[model samples]
Target: MGTTVLEEVVRNYRGQPEKLIAALLALQRHYGYLPEPALRVISQELRVPLSKIYGVATFYAQFRLQPRGKHTVCVCLGTACHVRGSEQIFHQLRRELGIEAGETTTDGRFTLEVVSCVGACSMAPIMMIDEDLHGRLDADKALALLTQYRD
Candidate 1:
């Protein structure tokens, strides 16, 4: 809605080409998603081409061109996790978040994603809250884990 953060970030960008990624990261941190208007503003402020900006955004997994949720829930769907009931975990999260894979919640509180593996096979059926991994999840355990973040 406002342009203060965007302007401030553009002002801090050095002339170096490498600063492009840093600038995008700052924008994402401020806005949660890279809106088209914001992208245009960034291009104008930095004097960088729009194509370059789009390229940088596309290159990075962290930069979301679309909206993202406040909390990201990543469930591992690796072989071990699958055998240990990760599908059930995925279902539970989808039902609780009210959004399918790669979607943010209506309230913008949570985003659900399924990853191929999280490397916690011993504790299969793991879900990560941001970077913190919770392992050995059953339906009840998963539900309880989600409750901790609910308003």
Candidate 2:
């Protein structure tokens, strides 16, 4: 995002440094991730150093620095999922997508990530694509599920 949309967001917060996190959040919602240039705009408008702004962005896991993919693949790694072989499923996804955790595929179709839990222990060995949760999966089954989303 350039100064145009970001400026509007900053203007909403009255350009207050105290509102940095809130401003960043609004921007994140708009762009899906915090663009580097967008951060510069926030720094200048709020009179906060870019380094400090970066600190806040990186400090929060909710803030993403890179662009998000069309689909997000989050593999559950909590104790319940782990015992059921979530790791194998995660590795298989990484291998198939050719992108490591927190990375989007080259085609920008998918992003792979690992999560501690999703509160569905009964559905052990779970991986989610976008907002849909799939459970009780083996590595092969996980790959098969991904195929459905390829289109």
Candidate closest to the true structure, highest lDDT: 2
- Model 1 misplacement above 4 A: 1-3, 14-18
Supply the TM-score for candidate 2. 0.93
Candidate 2: 10-residue stretch with minimal lDDT: 1-10
| Model 2 regions more than 4 Å off | 1-4
Q: Tens-digit lDDT track for model 1 on 1-151?
A: 7659877787788454567778888888888888889888778777789899998899878889989877789999999999999999899888877889999888988888999989889999899987778998887898898888776
lDDT of 2 by residue, 31-119 (tens): 99999988888888889999998899899889999999999999999999999999999988988999999999989899999999999
User: Candidate 2: what lDDT?
Assistant: 0.92
Worst lDDT 10-window in candidate 1: 10-19
Provide the TM-score for each candidate, comma-separated. 0.85, 0.93
